[model samples]
Target chain A: MAKSHEETADPSIYVPSQDEDMLKKQKKKEWKETLVGYAIISPWLLGFFLLILGPILASLYLSFTDYDLLSTPNWVGFDNYINILTSDPRFVQSLTVTLIFVFISTPLKLIFALGLAMLFNTGRKATGFFTTIYYIPSIIGGSVAIAVVWRQLFGRNGAINDILNSLGLSGLNWIGNPDTALSVLIILIVWQFGSPMIIFLAGLRQIPGELYEAASVDGANKVQTFIKITLPMLTPVIFFNLIMQTIGGFMIFTQAYLITQGGPMDSTLFYALYLYEMAFEYLRMGYASALAWILLVIIALITIIIFKTSSKWVFYESEGGR
Target chain B: MKKQNSKISDVIYYTFVAAFGFVMIYPILWMIMSSLKPEVEIFGNAASLVPGEFRWDNFSRGWEGFGGIGFDVYFRNSIIVTTLVVLGTVASASIVAYGFARINFKFKALLFGCLMATVMLPVQITLIPQYILFHNFGWVNTFYPLIVPAFLGGQPFFIFLLIQFIRGIPRELDEAATIDGCNKFGIFYKIILPLLKPALVTVVIFSFMWTWDDFLAPLIYLNNAGLHTVTLGLRNFMDADAGTNWGALLAMSSLSLLPQFILFAFFQKYLVEGIATTGIK
Candidate 1:
């Protein structure tokens, strides 16, 4: 209905004349193409503005006010931010736990992925058999079922301790101890390094065989060839994995939520779990909003840092990057 | 001597991978084995791989689920939600991908940039406000909150992947269709849709996997036990107090992973390829 006005008054825009017939046709085609393009993508367009963009901005606004979802938002500018940044112990605890998890687990997970990928890439015809077996965990790892199993595996008199005691080696209740709880979560994470391993395998394949052959011809050993040829070539993939896993590491929830419940004095209270508790459990939506904003800032900063520093270490084969 | 040494290294490689693979899947094996163990035997001989007697009734007992609701209801709920989610994601993502890959509209690049940025943005940033918005819509504690977003291009990763796939398709097909008097939409329907099958499969498998295993959305929305998905149902097993039915929990937990195992068995090639493509480039 709105376009009716534009259609009726379109003569001024493109006059139909003898000399300008082709040009008019071109203009009309362009207009139709644009219309079709928007029509095709309208779902995403509407979704973005409605679901994602609106909510992101609203959350930002809500972060500055006190809204408990039951009443109208009370404007208390920066109180959430002040208390979170200044004096809140749990906030500090969560931040510390998250940073520790991310910093420690990301590298270990990537390394494990890379090591296994290299092992798988060792020119064996039967390696596909191994990858299939190993990738099962990454598929089902995020489920509550697996998390439940993990809790049992590390329970006080669970299988781990039973096996340890049988071997005359006492094992601590890994999931029940503050000192070892985060390690349990880290192990869970590192164990599911299957997807990244596949990524590394793909990256390894793309490293030209000629490079390895040349290094071998030049009398380079395995470690030397890896360092001189493989590592630098794989840096771009490494950088990608780092950014992704770092983001994912910070968002660790299901494992910690189910396995330890952030227990043993909040030793494993991931940023996400805490934020969830604040919002839904405690009904401090405004403070949680602030915490969520702080998380976004932290993630954005870390991403930017990685990208900025990438120029120093990440080696793209050519400027025309893959 | 040199050949013998190389053969020994081969032996070492095979041994290491085999041993380590066992270590990797040990917990899962422990779980499946424990599912067959009696509750007393599950803990009493927890270190042992074999149970003295198999308690096959655990599966039946676990199938009864907590409260009055059975695992059948949970499975049905998950199947319904995941099916709709997968369909919506594939349909919407393919449509959007076609627009971006084939059409040259003004602001296309800008919108594409926004899509990529959304791919990088954390879900937590929008978690609260989306919850609030859904609450305003009176959609809380409903499957609508879990399934609606899929129809609306909520998953940028799928859109991004499909765009990459659609671009790889030769434009000559579209041009030929255009020459034959096929309109843009006709070309998309006739040419692009059929050709985009592989990418669509990738989309289907991933969307199915994620939605079926999705905990947060279901946790936030489906508070009623009658509507609990398998993941939530399994979580309730853990909530069953000190006299926990370890046998039932293990059995149900193992059962919860059946679909994933089936998918992995049948589509490991596609799954591996999807991971490779999505993870690296």
Candidate 2:
């Protein structure tokens, strides 16, 4: 039985010389491929070293120094961090604003985008047209012009209030009021939900039609089918949307920078915007680097937590298990 | 009975979706109308859905209002910057992506992962040091800082997207080319380049949209109003210190969106499909 098992396993294992020669030739081929590959991929490697990796390493060193733009950086161990964490209300405010924006916008976006995706998925007529129309806002929506338009629309005499007045109502100064400034931002973000919606639509297509058909034949109602089949199938896409939107939201800057100027009482001071103000406006390069590092840590922690939690809820089709 | 129930549910769904759509689109519609409304009528009848007069002259005024630097200059500058950036980025990113996807380098996966991590790193972290570096290099206040890095494969997202697409192509094609005595360069040129047309289109479109809309880079790098991109030019026009011309600003804003709108209308299908293919994955 042992001999038979050994023979079945391929006697190549026992013939060491033959195996070694084959392995040597395989390694030689692999070496050639690797060399050729390096030749082709050299551009990216060069880029990483020169542009990305080099800058990253430089920033790490700069964060340790009291560096302004004009002068040479002097070593100032942890002073920047200490000052930012302890003495800086601006940093705290920026953090609070960014967190609020991320929390509100991420959930709202996922719901709006997923809902719109469902709408397009169901609607029989010109689904492509609706998809395109919905997506237009996201494509052009990041411009300073759009942010300016958003500001005008929400300003004291802006279009939003105009509509409210037409309805025989008083209007709140949306962008000018501290309480409403960030809310207007939230609205702006939710409006640009078209990109995620397209992704969800693609995910929706991947769901087997027979599952829905089966659900219908089993006397399942529309809500029941959606709940039992569609939602579960779409969970992966929803997970993707959640992570991406969360990350995107955390990096929010342009809307606040252009619209509110982080104003109406600093209520809209997003972290990155504040970083810009510190580095450029105030010329506190060291402090700005510290802020950047803090933002990085926060983003990293959130992403790690998301990945850890994903194992519990994220469904994988190949595994045949949720 | 089930059919009837589903019909009602569908109606409910449509109502919910339509309400969301109305809200989603309302601000844009409102902006368009507001752009047409005169200053006198703006606040007086703020809620009027229709403008009293379609004040088409707002465009002309907005275009010419910026201290003799017509909106045409900013528009033209933006076109130049975006076109060059797109061409440069697409070319570099494809070459780099091809290298990563099709080549068999040592530690290839590790290197690729390192490249992707750059994407995760907030652009802000690199912002200060890069600005300083550029300043020392005398690239500041010029289009060099804006456009040169793109040619150096600066953007990780486009490279990653291209890599994913390149990997999906069959390796057998490369082997066949090699058997037919095509060199590595020939395989890349003849076999891979043709296959990557769809991905290249996607890269071009994305680069166009991003470069056109970028404000902060131009705000930081370019100091001269003469060299201002559309985003910067419009903001400069509306700056409170520079004297705000609301009507003129609105007109300029509308013009800024026109190119992207036109691009979208023409390539909406490819853009959407490309986004779905590359981004969603």
Candidate 3:
């Protein structure tokens, strides 16, 4: 191994001219590296073809066929797509519910995360402890058990209502009511904003201390310093969080499934949750496939829009990229 | 004048932050407390945060049996599945990430871009077909479906994360190694792998948590009770639609969360580093 290291070093890195023996050794090393690289990447390559790409294309094909678990798919081109778009009321409801969730939850989560990150950045002692406490909810928030606990806490006679009664207030049946069930899911999303908060904290750290000092020396008040210095500097991180949280929010399912089970007149029926119901309960494999494709297009469009708009506001540290 | 206002603001801030913290944690704390309280105490004084009696038996009972099936079996299954998935995700994701990060190849950007697209595709999109594919292979009711994909670089998000981390390592190290006659493979193993410990640990922790917490995959795949993971086992503890043996269920949930919480608490620095490294850049 060390011998190749000695052999391949160009006396002049930019110059290509070299000895024959050294050239031959470099070729041999290149061959070895290629072999190793292939070996290392084979896991992804194998997964790409077998698990990911295969299922994706298969789903596309499955979308045009009437297939159930019991039997082979019979080709039915355009029917699945047509049915979902024109005929399926459930599909429309699911899409509406999903869009509402994405719009509400993503913004709320971002605001919560940004606010917490700002507070923590104010040089508090035991910052790690507070951050960890906030993050623990995120770590376990999506678990089925947590969802069950959510259900219990929000149920008609649950702890939340119990507290309201103690305060001499009339208790509303939260989970049982359609209007409030969606709010519960949104609240769940917001509570788990800790991951983004931590990321924002890291982003905050990256804004040089010197900049704040300079702003302070310039006699800028704290609010001005924050607005002028911190917000602009944190925009990139915020944008990153926005993209990720949007994608994540658009795929919300577990809370819907475990907590409300898409109940109270389908108010909490998340897109993914509804898709699961279609695929499993109704055995609408083809229709579900079509729904999945539509979701993919929606996500792709959102991501593309983000990238397209990024140049206007995103402050890249480097100018190297064309 | 400004200092005094700021102090008042600080007090307001602390109050707001602490109150929100309490609300966020109240359910979790309530769950833990309820797990110790017997069934009668649960509804009798539901608003109370503390249990009247510490039912150590709740843990023992939850550990032993619920609905004629012992949690021991489910616990074993969870451990086995989570451990394997973590090991598999770390090994595969790191290797694949190294390949993407370090190795120059034909169509490299295209392939990496394709992998990125995979990250945006909803997992539910592939759920039906993947189940069909696995079912055809007789993988249902087995750990094969749950555990095997991790070894095959299952989670693209983790791979993307590791790829970013591996990119931050100086390419000069690879060049330096090459000058000393160390091949690309040698550079990856000897030079890059050590540098990726924090990222790899992050992948491991995420894989473990995801697999352990996952309900949909296990719900669809595992038909047998004995083969259930904790997520499935906990769901089964529910009587029909309603969850029974509230104390035991809460106890089991709390117990299930202990492993991940303990791991995170111990290695939090790595988690923080990993989150920053992956997301900030």
lDDT per residue for candidate 1 within A1-322, as digits (tens), equals 4345346755657656664566557778888889999999999999999899999999999999999999999999999999999999999999999999999988998999999999999897699999987888899888888898888888887888898999999989798789999998998998998889999999999999998888889999989998988899999999999999999988888888889999889999999999999998888899999999999999999999999999988888787443
* TM-score of every candidate relative to the true structure: 0.96, 0.91, 0.90
TM value for model 3? 0.90
lDDT, candidate 1, at A69: 91
Please list, in the order the candidates appear, how each scores on TM-score for chain B only. 0.97, 0.91, 0.92
Which stretch of 10 consecutive residues in model 2 chain A shows the poorest summed lDDT? Answer: A1-10
The numbered model that scores best in DockQ is 1
TM-score of 2: 0.91
> Compared with the true structure, what per-residue lDDT tens digits does model 3 show for residues A168-209?
997888988999999988888888888888999888889889
Off by over 4 Å in 2: A1-36, B1-22, B47-49, B240-244
Winner by TM-score between candidate 2 and candidate 1: 1
Question: Residue A90 deviation, candidate 3, in Å?
Answer: 0.6
Candidate 1 segments exceeding 4 Å error: A1-16, A320-322, B241-243
Better structure of 2 and 3 per TM-score: 2
**A182-262, model 2: which lDDT tens digit per residue?**
999888888888898889889998999999889888999989988888887888888878888888876777778888899
Residue B280, candidate 3: alpha-carbon lDDT: 25
Candidate order by lDDT, highest to lowest? 1, 3, 2
